[model samples]
Target: MATPLWLAGCVAAPKPSVQATLPPAPPPTLAPVEVEPAAPATQPASLFTLITQGPVSAMLSYSEKVRSLNGNELNAELARLGEPGDVPTAQMQTALALAQTRVPADLARAVGLLQRVAANTSAEARPLHPLARMLAARYLEQRRIEDDRDRQVAQLRDAQRRIDQLNDRIEALRAIERSFARPANGAAAAPASNGAKPAP
Candidate 1:
């Protein structure tokens, strides 16, 4: 009887409580990425500014050399630049022309050179330089004015010729009228001579 009681107590021992396991923590939070903004684009310099202040040609470096050059040196360089068959002749000419205009005395020469450059270009293809364009416009305007003057002169000549023809026609008509009048007068005199008189 004592052994049964002890066995019963051993079998009835309370089952241990089952504790639920917690899930693992999520991955560590990442700091937000700090992306830099893109840089803005820069604008290219103007053709006028480049020609006047910078080198017009890669073959000849005018920017730095021009700064150091005196008036004489600049003049000599301009003479060299003006020669025919120079490499990149158009650009060199433009640069030299721009430089020449800096001197008060040489401004006229610069305008002349610019005029030449402008004349060479057509409406379909124009120079990038502002001075070059202005020069071309001046050339075209001068030509247009000359053409208008010539046209007016031709018109005047034609009008004078027409007036002369009209005057000749009027004189011819007057002569015909005078001739007819004489015939009528002769007929009237002949009627009178034939003794046919108008009854009053």
Candidate 2:
């Protein structure tokens, strides 16, 4: 009925075995560098430049018109020029003066041209255009310069007054010293010995 040890060993099963493996090492990494971009072309004109250019161009055009007319065609020429604005208006007046010398008897026509110049000047001064504003600022600067000159002159005058006072004080001090300098004894009353007192 019982099984033998040799018989039990024959009934048991066998176990399985496994092997291990490793992968190869990887390569190193690197950092990247950056670059900047280029700037754009052609910027737009400024507002001040636009304003100044307008008046400047107007003046040039009006001056050319005045030259073409000279004194003979003042009325029609000025009409074509429209308005001087401010630029060459003064300059045109100078031109008119020069032209006048050449045609003295044509003074009437020259006067007409001058009147046109005056109109431009008045226009420039009124409503206060850029040219007029610039002129006014310059005038203000000139006035400041004159005022500074006056102040410096007044300061110099004050300095002179102080110097005169000091000089007068010095003269007065010299007079007081001169009065006290003389001795009670007269020069003619010297003793028999040189610079010695007489025996009492």
Per-residue lDDT of model 1, residues 52-136, tens digit only: 4543332134444554677777777667656533223344354444443354335444455555554555542243345455644
- Worst 10-residue stretch by lDDT in candidate 2? 38-47
Q: Which residue pairs clash in candidate 2? A: none
Q: Evaluated with lDDT, which candidate comes out highest?
A: 1
The lDDT per prediction is: 0.57, 0.50
Q: Which residue pairs collide, candidate 1?
A: none
* lDDT for each residue of candidate 2 in 78-125, tens digit (9 for 90 to 100): 445454344434434343433423333333443444444434546443
Q: Least accurate stretch of 10 residues (summed lDDT) in model 1? A: 38-47
* Deviation (Å) of 166 in candidate 2: 1.0
What is the clash count of model 1?
A: 0
Q: How accurate is candidate 1 locally (lDDT)?
A: 0.57
Q: What TM-score fits each model?
A: 0.35, 0.35
